[model samples]
Target: VNGQFVTDNGTNIFDIYKEELLKNPYTAENARIAASHYGSQLFDLAKNGFDSIPDLVLSISYQNGSLQDIGQKVNYGVKKTID
Candidate 1:
Protein backbone atom coordinates (compact mmCIF):
# COMPACT_ATOMS: atom_id res chain seq x y z
CA VAL A 1 0.00 0.00 0.00
CA ASN A 2 1.16 3.57 0.70
CA GLY A 3 4.30 3.47 2.84
CA GLN A 4 3.76 0.12 4.60
CA PHE A 5 0.13 0.70 5.41
CA VAL A 6 -3.12 0.30 3.51
CA THR A 7 -5.26 3.42 3.17
CA ASP A 8 -8.38 1.31 2.68
CA ASN A 9 -10.67 -0.68 4.93
CA GLY A 10 -7.70 -1.59 7.16
CA THR A 11 -7.82 -5.16 5.93
CA ASN A 12 -4.16 -5.79 5.33
CA ILE A 13 -3.63 -8.43 2.65
CA PHE A 14 -0.14 -9.16 3.85
CA ASP A 15 -1.27 -9.50 7.38
CA ILE A 16 -4.04 -11.82 6.32
CA TYR A 17 -1.54 -13.86 4.35
CA LYS A 18 0.86 -14.00 7.26
CA GLU A 19 -1.82 -14.94 9.71
CA GLU A 20 -3.41 -17.54 7.45
CA LEU A 21 -0.89 -18.70 4.86
CA LEU A 22 2.68 -18.06 6.00
CA LYS A 23 3.25 -21.46 7.56
CA ASN A 24 2.08 -23.58 4.63
CA PRO A 25 2.89 -23.55 0.96
CA TYR A 26 -0.46 -25.01 -0.06
CA THR A 27 -2.26 -22.43 1.99
CA ALA A 28 -0.05 -19.71 0.65
CA GLU A 29 -0.69 -20.76 -2.92
CA ASN A 30 -4.36 -20.77 -2.21
CA ALA A 31 -4.08 -17.25 -0.93
CA ARG A 32 -2.14 -16.33 -4.02
CA ILE A 33 -4.93 -17.63 -6.21
CA ALA A 34 -7.45 -15.73 -4.18
CA ALA A 35 -5.41 -12.60 -4.57
CA SER A 36 -5.32 -13.12 -8.29
CA HIS A 37 -9.06 -13.45 -8.38
CA TYR A 38 -9.49 -10.31 -6.38
CA GLY A 39 -7.15 -8.55 -8.75
CA SER A 40 -9.17 -9.67 -11.73
CA GLN A 41 -12.19 -8.22 -10.08
CA LEU A 42 -10.51 -4.86 -10.41
CA PHE A 43 -11.48 -4.84 -14.07
CA ASP A 44 -14.84 -3.63 -12.91
CA LEU A 45 -13.22 -0.64 -11.29
CA ALA A 46 -11.39 -0.15 -14.61
CA LYS A 47 -8.40 -2.08 -15.88
CA ASN A 48 -6.25 0.51 -14.14
CA GLY A 49 -8.27 1.12 -10.98
CA PHE A 50 -9.84 4.02 -9.18
CA ASP A 51 -7.51 7.00 -8.91
CA SER A 52 -7.11 6.55 -5.19
CA ILE A 53 -5.21 3.30 -5.76
CA PRO A 54 -1.45 3.50 -5.36
CA ASP A 55 -0.29 1.40 -8.34
CA LEU A 56 -1.42 0.55 -11.85
CA VAL A 57 -2.67 -2.96 -12.49
CA LEU A 58 -1.15 -5.68 -14.66
CA SER A 59 -3.69 -6.49 -17.36
CA ILE A 60 -4.45 -2.88 -18.27
CA SER A 61 -0.97 -1.62 -18.93
CA TYR A 62 1.55 -4.41 -18.81
CA GLN A 63 3.99 -3.28 -21.51
CA ASN A 64 4.26 0.44 -20.91
CA GLY A 65 7.81 1.53 -20.10
CA SER A 66 7.06 3.59 -17.03
CA LEU A 67 4.91 0.89 -15.51
CA GLN A 68 7.43 -1.78 -16.36
CA ASP A 69 10.14 0.29 -14.74
CA ILE A 70 8.14 0.79 -11.60
CA GLY A 71 7.35 -2.92 -11.42
CA GLN A 72 10.99 -3.72 -12.01
CA LYS A 73 12.17 -1.48 -9.21
CA VAL A 74 9.62 -2.69 -6.70
CA ASN A 75 9.76 -6.34 -7.76
CA TYR A 76 13.51 -6.82 -7.38
CA GLY A 77 14.25 -6.90 -11.12
CA VAL A 78 11.25 -9.01 -12.02
CA LYS A 79 8.76 -7.22 -14.24
CA LYS A 80 5.26 -8.03 -15.39
CA THR A 81 4.09 -10.96 -13.39
CA ILE A 82 1.08 -11.31 -15.68
CA ASP A 83 2.03 -9.93 -19.07
Candidate 2:
Protein backbone atom coordinates (compact mmCIF):
# COMPACT_ATOMS: atom_id res chain seq x y z
CA VAL A 1 0.00 0.00 0.00
CA ASN A 2 1.28 3.48 -0.79
CA GLY A 3 -0.23 4.93 2.36
CA GLN A 4 -1.92 3.73 5.53
CA PHE A 5 -5.60 3.75 6.43
CA VAL A 6 -4.82 5.29 9.79
CA THR A 7 -2.14 7.95 10.00
CA ASP A 8 -0.67 10.29 12.58
CA ASN A 9 -2.53 13.22 11.00
CA GLY A 10 -5.78 11.25 11.09
CA THR A 11 -7.32 9.33 8.20
CA ASN A 12 -7.69 10.68 4.69
CA ILE A 13 -9.00 7.77 2.58
CA PHE A 14 -8.36 9.49 -0.73
CA ASP A 15 -4.61 9.85 -0.29
CA ILE A 16 -3.98 6.11 0.10
CA TYR A 17 -4.93 5.23 -3.45
CA LYS A 18 -1.89 5.12 -5.74
CA GLU A 19 -3.43 4.26 -9.11
CA GLU A 20 -5.68 7.29 -9.58
CA LEU A 21 -8.23 5.33 -7.54
CA LEU A 22 -11.33 6.94 -8.92
CA LYS A 23 -10.03 9.65 -11.19
CA ASN A 24 -11.37 8.07 -14.35
CA PRO A 25 -14.14 5.81 -13.14
CA TYR A 26 -17.62 6.27 -14.51
CA THR A 27 -20.33 7.27 -12.06
CA ALA A 28 -22.95 4.56 -11.80
CA GLU A 29 -24.60 2.57 -9.04
CA ASN A 30 -23.55 2.52 -5.39
CA ALA A 31 -19.79 2.40 -4.84
CA ARG A 32 -18.00 -0.80 -3.89
CA ILE A 33 -14.32 -1.15 -3.07
CA ALA A 34 -11.94 -2.41 -5.72
CA ALA A 35 -10.36 -4.77 -3.23
CA SER A 36 -12.14 -6.64 -0.46
CA HIS A 37 -9.40 -6.47 2.14
CA TYR A 38 -10.87 -3.69 4.21
CA GLY A 39 -13.92 -4.22 6.37
CA SER A 40 -15.38 -0.76 6.82
CA GLN A 41 -14.88 2.95 6.41
CA LEU A 42 -15.66 5.97 8.50
CA PHE A 43 -15.82 9.57 7.45
CA ASP A 44 -16.20 12.00 10.30
CA LEU A 45 -15.78 15.72 10.17
CA ALA A 46 -16.75 18.58 12.45
CA LYS A 47 -16.88 22.32 12.02
CA ASN A 48 -18.34 23.52 15.34
CA GLY A 49 -17.23 20.30 17.10
CA PHE A 50 -19.27 18.08 19.37
CA ASP A 51 -20.06 17.26 22.99
CA SER A 52 -19.79 13.85 24.65
CA ILE A 53 -22.50 11.24 23.98
CA PRO A 54 -24.20 11.84 27.35
CA ASP A 55 -24.10 15.59 26.90
CA LEU A 56 -25.42 15.24 23.34
CA VAL A 57 -28.28 13.06 24.55
CA LEU A 58 -29.15 15.61 27.20
CA SER A 59 -29.11 18.33 24.60
CA ILE A 60 -31.61 16.42 22.49
CA SER A 61 -33.80 15.45 25.47
CA TYR A 62 -34.07 19.09 26.51
CA GLN A 63 -34.83 20.31 22.96
CA ASN A 64 -31.63 22.28 23.02
CA GLY A 65 -30.75 21.11 19.53
CA SER A 66 -32.63 19.49 16.70
CA LEU A 67 -31.87 15.96 15.53
CA GLN A 68 -30.52 17.34 12.28
CA ASP A 69 -28.15 19.62 14.17
CA ILE A 70 -27.13 16.87 16.54
CA GLY A 71 -26.66 14.52 13.61
CA GLN A 72 -24.15 16.90 12.12
CA LYS A 73 -22.23 16.62 15.34
CA VAL A 74 -22.41 12.85 15.84
CA ASN A 75 -23.18 11.21 12.54
CA TYR A 76 -23.64 7.39 12.52
CA GLY A 77 -23.90 7.52 8.75
CA VAL A 78 -23.29 4.12 7.14
CA LYS A 79 -23.04 0.61 8.58
CA LYS A 80 -22.42 -2.37 6.34
CA THR A 81 -21.02 -5.84 6.97
CA ILE A 82 -19.87 -7.84 4.00
CA ASP A 83 -19.21 -11.53 3.80
Candidate 3:
Protein backbone atom coordinates (compact mmCIF):
# COMPACT_ATOMS: atom_id res chain seq x y z
CA VAL A 1 0.00 0.00 0.00
CA ASN A 2 2.93 2.31 -0.38
CA GLY A 3 1.66 3.86 -3.62
CA GLN A 4 -1.03 5.94 -5.19
CA PHE A 5 -4.36 4.64 -6.54
CA VAL A 6 -4.84 6.81 -9.55
CA THR A 7 -6.84 5.19 -12.38
CA ASP A 8 -4.04 4.47 -14.86
CA ASN A 9 -1.59 3.87 -12.05
CA GLY A 10 -3.95 1.28 -10.61
CA THR A 11 -3.65 -0.77 -13.79
CA ASN A 12 0.13 -0.91 -13.42
CA ILE A 13 -0.04 -2.28 -9.89
CA PHE A 14 -2.52 -4.95 -10.90
CA ASP A 15 -0.38 -5.86 -13.88
CA ILE A 16 2.60 -6.46 -11.63
CA TYR A 17 0.67 -8.71 -9.30
CA LYS A 18 -0.76 -10.61 -12.25
CA GLU A 19 2.65 -10.99 -13.80
CA GLU A 20 3.92 -12.40 -10.54
CA LEU A 21 1.03 -14.78 -10.34
CA LEU A 22 1.43 -16.01 -13.89
CA LYS A 23 5.12 -16.67 -13.41
CA ASN A 24 4.46 -18.98 -10.47
CA PRO A 25 3.17 -22.50 -10.80
CA TYR A 26 -0.57 -22.55 -11.07
CA THR A 27 -0.62 -25.24 -8.38
CA ALA A 28 1.79 -23.39 -6.15
CA GLU A 29 -0.70 -23.49 -3.29
CA ASN A 30 -1.05 -19.75 -3.16
CA ALA A 31 -4.11 -17.58 -2.79
CA ARG A 32 -5.89 -16.56 -5.98
CA ILE A 33 -8.77 -14.27 -6.69
CA ALA A 34 -10.67 -13.08 -9.73
CA ALA A 35 -8.51 -10.84 -11.86
CA SER A 36 -10.96 -8.01 -11.41
CA HIS A 37 -10.93 -8.33 -7.66
CA TYR A 38 -7.17 -8.55 -7.74
CA GLY A 39 -7.09 -5.32 -9.65
CA SER A 40 -9.48 -3.72 -7.19
CA GLN A 41 -7.39 -4.89 -4.28
CA LEU A 42 -4.34 -3.35 -5.89
CA PHE A 43 -6.25 -0.13 -6.19
CA ASP A 44 -7.19 -0.23 -2.55
CA LEU A 45 -3.69 -1.06 -1.50
CA ALA A 46 -2.33 1.81 -3.54
CA LYS A 47 -4.81 4.21 -2.04
CA ASN A 48 -3.97 3.07 1.44
CA GLY A 49 -0.30 3.75 0.64
CA PHE A 50 1.04 1.53 3.45
CA ASP A 51 -1.61 2.74 5.84
CA SER A 52 -3.55 0.18 7.85
CA ILE A 53 -7.01 -0.38 6.51
CA PRO A 54 -9.76 -1.81 8.65
CA ASP A 55 -11.40 -5.00 7.42
CA LEU A 56 -9.40 -5.59 4.27
CA VAL A 57 -10.53 -8.51 2.20
CA LEU A 58 -8.07 -11.19 1.11
CA SER A 59 -8.13 -14.09 -1.35
CA ILE A 60 -8.16 -17.78 -0.46
CA SER A 61 -5.53 -20.23 -1.69
CA TYR A 62 -6.09 -23.31 -3.79
CA GLN A 63 -3.94 -25.87 -5.57
CA ASN A 64 -4.45 -25.82 -9.31
CA GLY A 65 -2.26 -27.50 -11.88
CA SER A 66 -2.62 -24.80 -14.48
CA LEU A 67 -4.77 -21.94 -15.64
CA GLN A 68 -6.92 -24.52 -17.37
CA ASP A 69 -7.26 -26.37 -14.11
CA ILE A 70 -8.36 -23.20 -12.41
CA GLY A 71 -10.96 -22.65 -15.10
CA GLN A 72 -12.19 -26.20 -14.78
CA LYS A 73 -12.47 -25.87 -11.04
CA VAL A 74 -14.48 -22.70 -11.34
CA ASN A 75 -16.71 -24.20 -13.98
CA TYR A 76 -17.25 -27.36 -11.99
CA GLY A 77 -18.10 -25.44 -8.89
CA VAL A 78 -20.60 -23.33 -10.75
CA LYS A 79 -22.13 -26.34 -12.43
CA LYS A 80 -22.51 -28.12 -9.14
CA THR A 81 -24.24 -25.14 -7.63
CA ILE A 82 -26.53 -24.75 -10.62
CA ASP A 83 -27.43 -28.40 -10.69
Cα lDDT computed for each candidate against the true fold: 0.51, 0.36, 0.54
Q: Residues 15-50, candidate 1: write the lDDT tens digits.
A: 664556646767665776765675455434443447
Each candidate: RMSD to true structure?
13.4, 13.7, 13.8
Ranking by TM-score: 3, 1, 2
TM-score of 3: 0.33
Best lDDT among the predictions, by candidate number: 3
lDDT of 3 by residue, 1-83 (tens): 24644345455556666667767787224535655666777676767655666665544434343222332445433224554
**Residue runs of model 2 more than 4 Å from their true location after superposition:** 1-4, 12-15, 24-83
Poorest 10 consecutive residues by lDDT, candidate 2: 39-48
User: In candidate 3, which residue ranges exceed 4 Å CA deviation?
Assistant: 1-11, 27-33, 55-83
How many pairs of residues collide in model 1? 0
Q: Write the per-residue lDDT of candidate 2 for residues 1-83, one digit (tens) a residue.
A: 23234557775454454234445465222124642223222222122223322353433322324232353445432342233
Give the Cα RMSD of candidate 3: 13.8
As for lDDT, the candidate ahead, 1 or 2, is: 1
